[model samples]
Target: MKLCVIPARGGSKRIPRKNIKEFCGQPIIAYSIQAARKTGLFDHIVVSTDDDEIAEIARSYGAETPFRRPAEISDDHTGTNAVVKHAILWFQENGTPVDLVCCIYATAPFVQEDYLQLGHDKLIQSDKSFAFSVTSFPFPIQRALKITQNGGLSAFYPEFRSTRSQDLEDAYHDAGQFYWGSAKAFLQEHELFSNQSLPILLPRHLVQDIDTPEDWIRAEYMYKAIHSSI
Candidate 1:
């Protein structure tokens, strides 16, 4: 059975109460919950959170919070992999065995049902054990430079210093939105990307990592523009 886990910790320092913050007309987490539900891909859509308020909102959006996340896994210092592992173990102890797990973030308000479906389909169709969304860097990374304290400019990739953008190989970065992986592989590797991992490229407009107020506003605006056209 495929399980979709949305990890929403209560303590958010950058944007206070970020998980429950309103986006468009609903809570920020509502988007991920709705997308997971709409995809109808997983056997269960669960929210692993330490905050009662966030749990309540998650339930209202049709996601189940079978257990409250432990304090250790709910703190800012906690990594997402730890939270996901805890959730998987919680379900395993309860007798509901999971085959695959999708770790969806609460702050990713731009996640769409189609994207989730695509990732799910790819994971099933390919020999890969994991798949996740990514977006290409807007600027050519070959030309990227780092400034030194002595006012010296050095190329991030020294080999690409003399290379033109069009001639350089393309690169992509993690969208920080969602990830899908086999439960067995995750338990063994403790990571989403292993040898058998695939990347799903997403459009720049649909990919935003919301960590600050400015990012939140930009994501909101992008969401509106995308949905308004649809």
Candidate 2:
């Protein structure tokens, strides 16, 4: 069986109730649940959360809340792999073992069924242990600058200062959307960013980090631009 696990903790310091906070017209978490369902990929769609409200919201949107995440793994310091491991163990304990698991982020408003399908297909077809979302950086990272303690700017790579932007190698970063992995890789807690993984590149316009309030506003604009009706 294939499983889709969404890790949504309640203690969001930046935006309280962020998992269930309305994005566009529905709760942010709804998008994730809907996307997982739309793909017809997984046998189960589970939401790992500590808050009762979050659990209820997830179930309302057609995701299973088989277990409330323990405080130890629900805290701010808990990494996503740990939560995913816990969910896998839960099913294993019930004699319903899964072969592949997909970790979908609750804050990913731009996630689509086709992208999830691509990640899963890539993971199954490739030798890599995992496949996840990524997008090219809007600007070249080689030209990055840093501010000194005294407020003076310095090039992180002085050699690149003289190079034209077009000459620099293309850079990409994790889209922070979803990850599809074999049960073995996730159970072993292997690194996801290494060469052992493949990336399902997304369009830059579909990628947005909704962390701070400013990011939230920027995401709203981006979302509208991506989906004309929204």
lDDT of each: 0.88, 0.93
Measured with C-alpha atoms, the lDDT of residue 165 in candidate 1 is 78
Candidate number achieving the greatest TM-score relative to the actual structure: 2
Which tens-of-lDDT digit does each residue in 46-162 have in candidate 1? 999989999999999899999999987777688777877888888899998988899999989888888888888898888787899899999988788999999999888888777
Q: Summing lDDT over every window of 10 consecutive residues in candidate 1, give the lowest-scoring window.
A: 186-195
Q: State every prediction's TM-score relative to the real structure.
A: 0.94, 0.98
Record all residue pairs in model 2 with backbone atoms less than 3 Å apart, i.e. clashing.
Answer: none
Model 2 residue runs over 4 Å out of place are none
Decoy 2 TM-score against native: 0.98
